[model samples]
Each structure stands twice: as C-alpha cells, then as structure tokens.
Target chain A: MPRQRPPAIRIALCLAALAAGLLPWWNAREMAKSAFPGFEVTAPSAGESGEPAFFKKTVVNPFSPHKKSHSASLVRMEDGRMFAAWYAGSGECAPDVAVYLASTDAAGNWQAPRAIFNREKAMADLGRNVISVGNALLLADGNRLGLLFVTVAAGRWSGSSMNIAWSDDAGMTWSRAQNLTMNPLANLSALPRNPASPLAGGGWAVPVYEEFLGKFPEVLWLLPRGGGYDFAVSRVAGGVSVMQAALVPLSRTDAVCLMRDFRPAQFMSISSTADAGRTWTPPQATELPNKDSGICGARLPDGSILAAYNDRSTGKRENLRLAVSGDGGKTWKRVATLEEEPGFEFSYPSMVCDPDGTVRMLYSARQTQIVYVEFNTAWLKEQEVLQ
Target chain B: MSTLTVFLLVVWFFQRVLPVRGLLGLGVSTAAGAAFVFIPWLGFWIKSLAPNASIPMVGLLLAAILGRACNKSVFRPADWKAAWIFGAAASLMLYPSALGLGAFDTYSLGWPWLFHSVSIALFAGVGVASAVLLWLGNRFGYLLLLAGLGYLAGFQESTNFWDYVLDPLFGAVSLVALIAMAWRSRNPRPANPRGTTAP
Candidate 1:
C-alpha cells in the first residue's frame, strides 16, 4: 500500500552509510598504530653506589596551617630540588580544604607550604559547583611541576573527579586547571594519591584509584605526544576491594603495584606486570598489613624495594613502618618504625628514591602536620643488619 | 566541546522555559543561552547532572525538540524510538560492569583500540548498526554517523569511544521510555464505541 523510495537514493544512502561506518574504524586503526613503546623505566643507577648517607627532618609550614593534613607526596625536580604537596582543611572532604605545596631551598630548609589549589579555585576554573578538594599528588615532568588532585562536585568521595595543573616556575605559580575525564557519567570518582613513575619514552605512569561504585587501582599513562601529553588509563586489576596503588617500575618491562586492601583480609595486596602495565596479575595478599590506608614504594640502587605503610593487622593507622623487599615485593622485612602511638594516627606514607640513592619519605603526622623523613641505603643496610 | 554541550543543553532548557509558539522562539532561546552561561550556579547544576555526555546526542535531541516547537518536523516518532532502543542497549552492555558488578570493566575497553580487541569489536558493531539504521530510513542513523565522526575528532573531553556514543542520563531516559512503551503495548486502551480511543 506504500510507494517505495527510489533505488538511486537508497544506493546513495548506503554508500554514505558505509563511509560513516568506516570512519570510526579507520580512526581506531590509525590510533592503534601508535602503540605505547613500553615504559621508559629508569632504575636508580649505581652513581656513588656505596655512599653512606642518612638524613631525617620534618618539613612543616611556618604559618598557621589547617587543622587536618593528609596524603603527602614528594618529587625531586630536574634541578635536584625537592618539592612536597599535601591537602589540609577542617577535615577530610571539608569545603575549606585546599592543596598545599612546599619546596626545599638551596640551604636545605623547607619553605612554608602555600595553598596551591582549593574548592573556590576549582569552582571558578571548572565553571562548576565544587564541594571540596583533596588527595594532591606532585609529579616532575622535566622542568615542569604537575599537580593532580581530586575535586568533589555533588556527594562525598564517590562524587569526585581528577584535575591536573602544571607549574613551570617550580611551584611559584601554577597554570589553570584541566579536568581529566576519567568517567563519562558525571566524571565521578577518580583520585590520585601517589606520584607518577617515569616511563621508557619520557612519559609517566601515574597511579590513581576509583572509590564510587567499587574500590580499585588504575594507572593513568601520560605519554608524551608532540609538545603535550596523551592520556590513557589501564586497570591494574579488577575488584571492589583494592585501591590507592603505588606503582614501582623495576625495569623497562617490569613493575609491581602495591595496593591498599579494603577487604576483610586487611593485608596489602601486590600485582606485577612483566610488560609494563599492559596487563597485570590479579593482586595477591602480601605479608604486610594494610587497614584500608595508603602506602608507597620506590626502587633502590641495589635492586631492592623500600615500602612505607601503616604496619598493623588490628586496623589502626597508629604505627607506620618501613620494610625492605629483595624478592620483587614477594616478602618484606620490617626495618624501621617511623611512627608508633596507639592513640594517635600517622598514615598515608609516600616514598621516593633520589638519583643519588637517597630515600625521602613523607606522611601525615597525627592528621595535623606533614612530616618528612630522609634516609639512604647505608641507613637501610644498617637497619637490615640490626633486624 | 564541554562548553558547546553546555550551550546546546542550555538552549534546549530555554526553549522549555520560554515555550514561544514559532521560529521566533529560537531568538529568545539564543538570548537565554548567552545569559545562562554567565549565570554561574545554573550552568553548574546542568553540567553536574550529565557532565561528559555525548555532544551529538544532546545536539540531536535539542534539534528534534526545537523543530517540533517551531512547527517543523525534523524527526518522526519512529526515529526517536529507534534511538532510544539503540542507546538503551549500549548502556546495558556498559554500566553493569562499569559499576563493578563484574570482574572486568567495560568502560576501560574504550580507552583505545590497541590494547583491547573488545573496543574494535564494539566500534564495528556501531558501524553495522549505523548501516542498518540508514537502510531502515531512520534519521537516528545520521546521529550515529555524526557520533563516529565526532569521536574521530576527539569532540568530547573523554577519549573513550563509549563516552562519545552513550551517556548515563541518555541511557536512563531511553531505558525508562522503552519500559513504558512495552507496558503500554501490552495493555492497550479500550476502543471507544466510535472506533477511536478517548483522549
């Protein structure tokens, strides 16, 4: 009962349809041509291999800071200058919270940390209603200092997203913020805790986590593209219980991820990748205890791993300890106790190894101050013998 | 791209708010879109609802609604129904795993086409679906084609292919409408004595 459309029009439509279908496939094929050339891992070289150096100090803001501070991260710049960042406010997820940054001067004195970003700045830059800001991580990309932090828009931690900003003049001034579209649905729940590790091609493998629907660890790859960077995310493992991964690249083709355990197991989980981060073994529990708190790790010049985490099985973040692993994180031996007071909290430890074999550590002290600790393999060797 | 989506969505909202009778209403809609961007909290609320939704989806819906409000039929009811069914299916295939119901994340497969074969398969599936829609003479097929081009141009903040094709809000609406349509089909209104249904 209906007159048919012309066959010529249908033919034209089909040809156009074929082109449309091929366009995305063509784009995808072109994109796949530039596969990641593996991580450009730089294990600490044996520069001054046997140097016996040990240093410890607490870098705090001279002015009156916020009531609470947590998630401290440290990065060594190209000029060998050390910079630190952490978020502080009335409480976690509080509207008053702001990300703060500090750098050590030539005289080795830590300058007062100044507020680098906050909810108001986020609201203004993002043109959205931001509820709070938290979990700031500092990354060194050549001479540029990059800060990745979390901004909550509507709800609690579940309603959060990640934003990145760069400072070219060593944290004196920062560029405008750009949101990382980690999720398309309201861009919810992507948080960065640990600083990134150097990849093979002058790129960075930043460790971040998701906490909204499920808790899991993911790696955000910032591969150099022309003069800027291309972003990609690879899931370390799939689960609802492990998150806040600390990625430590052991070689160009090998890395281990340390994850915070949110399950009843209460032990830190470990996953390894033999081909950069393209694929990972499902996380298995390590002997190290983790009570849903943050952890960090770095590779020493001796091919050893030094990890800092809240070492407890009873689910209290009152004790922070250092552990050394020679078997690629399969086992760990406690070397030093950095903080131990049952009534107080000292958690969220972030560690990084300097080129000259100096291990710098940072963590929240009593949830009120950011504490910095430095040591060397000489100190670690001594602690190992003592243990 | 985000700013563009915000502008388009705001224009659609303005049409609803003003609801003037003809093509003249679009002038009012443009004025409202320009003013709302500077109005601060209003823009944020809209973005907070669906921040990273596909641009073509929003743009197409806006065009359809405006055409009707201006007494110009750009899309028939069948075109919208087809789009709803397509979008709802895509969402179901993604959100369950993305929300952590399974061990694998469907969302991560959208990062690029190299690491996962699933992405290529999904892309090819979309291509086939586009061809089928075009063959059926549905205008929603054009939307699908535009989404593919937009994806190639990186028209959205997200590089994931799924983000350019489907979003949670659109998926939710499509799913609800499909369910209602199914329910109504199962229980048709009784025919009037004059062989017409009551209004």
Candidate 2:
C-alpha cells in the first residue's frame, strides 16, 4: 500500500478517496446542495479515524492560583500545543476574578495553568466590572492572542466592554491587557472567528454587546495597531435594544448579521451589508427558530450556514442547539443539540473551526464549562436531522 | 426527519419514557456520570466497580443474580477471540490519527483541553452504547449503534479513545470472539482441573 504507489498519486488518491467516500455529506455542495462539484465528505467508519472522542482537560486551577475558576476558552497553536484560559472567580459571577492559562501536548493532555493577565489593576482602574479578561478569544497571525470579556464597572453583571491580550510565547509571558471598547458599555465578547483566515485588513472582529442606553452588540474590527487593539465598531443597530446578534462572513464584500428583538419570543431580525462590515441594513424579523435564546451563527465554506440556538423562543438555554441554513440565513433547520438535558444550561456558546479542521465550541452551562465538537465538511453536510 | 416527525418523536419518547421520576433518575445518574468523567481522581474507583463487563454495565447487578437461575448456555459460545484482535487493530489504526498521527486529521487541530476531554467522553459513551447494543439482537442493535454514533458526529471532537466508538470494528470483533469461544466450547478439553488449559 505504501511503496507501489507514487507519493503524489498516493496523496491525491487518499484525498480523492476521502472526498469521494464522504459522498453522503452535502456541505461540500453549493446552491441546491446537489451542486457540489469538487469535494465530497469522507466519513470514516466509527472505528476508523473519524471517530469522535474527548481531547483532554485543564482545570486551569493547576496552580490553584485562586480559590475558584470558571468560563474557559481553548486554542490550538501552529505547533500543535493546546492553550486554554478561564476566569477564576471566587464564586459564580463573583468580583475577585482573573483569567488563567493552561497548555496541552498534541495529544490533548493539559499542562499546569498560569495567570495570563490579572484583574487587580483593571478592577481598581475601572472597578470590579473588569472581572476576568478572556471568556472568548481571537488568535492571529505571528502568534498574537486577542481576548474580550465582561466586567461590571457599575453593578453586578452590569458594565461590560471588550479587552484584548496576547502572548508571543504561549503564556510564558503576555503583553499587558488593554481595553478594546471605545468607551465603557454594559458587556462585550470577542465574537469567535477561525484562525489563519484573513480579515478585511488583517484585523479581526471583536463582538461587543452593550447594555446601558442604546447599548447593542456591534461587530468591532480590531487591528493590531501600535502593539494594542486599535478598535472600531460597526453600528450593529441604532437602539441599545437590539442585542444578541449572530455574524457570518459571506465574502470579502459581504457579511450577515442576525440581530434579535429585545422582546422575548419575538422573531430574530437581520441586518446585512454588501460592503463588508462597514454598514448593515435595518434588522427585520425572520421565521428562523430561535427560542428567544441567544444565538451563534457561522458561515460554512460551502456557503451553507450554521446557527447555534434553541428551538422555541422559550426553550432552556441549556436546551440549546444547532441549526443549518442552506440558503444563506433565509431559513434554518435545527441540526443538533449543542448540549442536552442533564446539562441543561449550555448557554453563550462560542464556535470556531481552527485551521487544522478542529471545530471548537465553548459554552457556559451549569457553571461555565465549554463543550467542544468537531466534524469535517463531511459530517456537517450530512442531511440535517432537526429536532 | 422533518420538524413534525422529530416533534412527534420527542413527544412520544418523552411521554412514554421520560416521566418525572425518570427525569429525576436521569438527573441523579447523569450527575454521577459527569463526576465520574470530569473528576480525574475517581477514574480508578469507577473502573474497579465495573470490571469484567462480559455483560454491559447497566444490567450488571440484575444479571449477576439471574445468572444462577438461568441456564448457563443460552447460545453456544462462538470462537470470538477475533473480536479482541479486530478491536486492537482498529485501535492501533485510529488511535494515531486522532493523536495527530499519520497526517490524518479531523477536528482537535486546535482546541481547549476541556473540549478535548469532553470529546473523548462522547466517544467513550458511544463505545459503551455500541457494546450494549451488540447483545440486543442485530437488526435493532445496528440502529441503536447509529444513534450512538450520531451523538458523536454531532459534537466537535478531540483525539482520544479508539477513533471509533461502536462500529464495524465492534461487529467484526464480536464475530471473531464469538467464533473463537464456540470453537473452544464445542471441543472442551478437560483441563487438569487446576483451571489451567495447556492441551
């Protein structure tokens, strides 16, 4: 099997074989899904290489730095080393908090965790709203790390904005944390994005959600300017009422923003732009199934779309799930449960597919634990089975 | 499946099986299960409790008591050592690919350790499920096995466990093991009664 075949032939054959074997997967297709021309999904038999399993765990408290910890995000670097960070809180949503780090070998085993950045200064400078820095992250070219998190500058869970941090040495040392917000708002998160993929100007979008007056979520493009996050926000909406927006990149000139109505059980609104993230049309309600639950959306390379959400407007956030959009964001069919019953709280789920094809999903349910799932273009392309 | 079909399925399954009481049982057991997986310190304790799962774990206590009353040989044991061989081979093949070996990569290229750990748990769950399904008769067993598998592909994955949970490997291994066991049983050679067989 190894010697008889030329190296290139073998490589091409394997790729072709996988692409062919995964014929059942439709994500490779475009237009009507039957339009897929080049690649096919190659799902290995269960006992084969595609089998699904857990990677490894890092308590983040490996150093037992603080008395508590919660809300973690993981990133696998170019070298196959896994880096994880989380907020160490004295209690759920507590003020005495700081984000920490841990690394894993290629096999996924975790190393001891350390404090990538502390909250004492941010907490003192801005008050305790700067709880922990990275509940979400954006890793960039040249080994830069971008993170955003929520903190209360005013009241509990009240004040939130974006903050950015980085480590050239994977936490051996990190640059000092800086705020990503233009001015302080209620809350913000670095909307997750794929790595090694370019942005409009080599900068990435840090999703900021506001709470005060007219405080809404905006897609803020952050470029690594002058060794800090030089940030700018796109008006996700004029009113602070429009919040919990889902973003998807269609092309260099287009992006989709799915904004939701402030009222519960209402239709989710959409605001899209043909000129990249510069501007978006006014949001209107859509028939997509969103149980007033928060939603996360992403664009598949095949032009199909994926949204993480609940079925009805009132399903438990942990009852949250995945839905696919075959025709842009026009409609969606519920795909799979991001988290199910026994763990009925997988909320605020963040998803990103790293360059190596691993899809990372992070969510906080029953106390801020991240549940990650991965599949090739093949698995996702399977005829969706909705609930 | 359509939304209506799934809605019906959920209603039917939940109405029939997920009673308030069952929900409570699920809650308690699930919490226990989560502790068993997430708390690394308790792994040995759980492993020691479920050794020799010749039968699956769910039915162990009942099966032990019933073993004395029931006839020992339900079906002639087959020569089933092949199951282990297939299982080990499958493991060797899939394990490396998952561990970022042999240039075959699925997810887990970049992920947090918790995500990786959880991905392993999902596959492990699929493994245990397929094993139990194997004894429940073949046609429906394959269906349950697929459901177990679907649970796996549905989640982002990590490199851990045998890349496969319940799969052709299970069927292949079971076939071999059963055949080996039957061959041994049909030609039972009297050991020197010391519980050792060399002949």
Per-residue error (Å), model 1, residue A102: 0.7
Worst 10 residues of 1 chain B by lDDT: B112-121
Q: Note the Cα lDDT for every prediction shown.
A: 0.79, 0.44
Q: What would the TM-score be for candidate 1 when compared with the true structure? A: 0.90
lDDT of 2: 0.44
* lDDT, candidate 2, A1-387, per-residue tens: 112345565444434323322321222122111110111122222222353433322233434535445455655566766666666656644556666666766666666665555556554433223433434454545465545544434333334444555667656765555544232111222233222123643555544444444435555554544555333444555553456666666666666676655656466666776765545676767676554556666666555667766556445454766677777677777765545675356555556554333455555555444344555444443425324
TM-score of each: 0.90, 0.49
After superposition, the stretches of candidate 1 with alpha carbons farther than 4 Å from their true spots are A1-25, A28-34, A43-48, B1-39, B63-73, B113-117, B197-199
What are the RMSDs of all candidates, in order?
A: 3.2, 26.5
TM-score, model 2 to reference: 0.49
In candidate 1 the C-alpha lDDT for residue A94 amounts to 95
Off by over 4 Å in 2: A1-76, A91-93, A110-113, A121-136, A184-198, A224-229, A354-358, A381-387, B1-199
Q: Give the DockQ (2 decimals) of all models.
A: 0.46, 0.01
- Candidate 2: residue B20 lDDT (0-100): 41
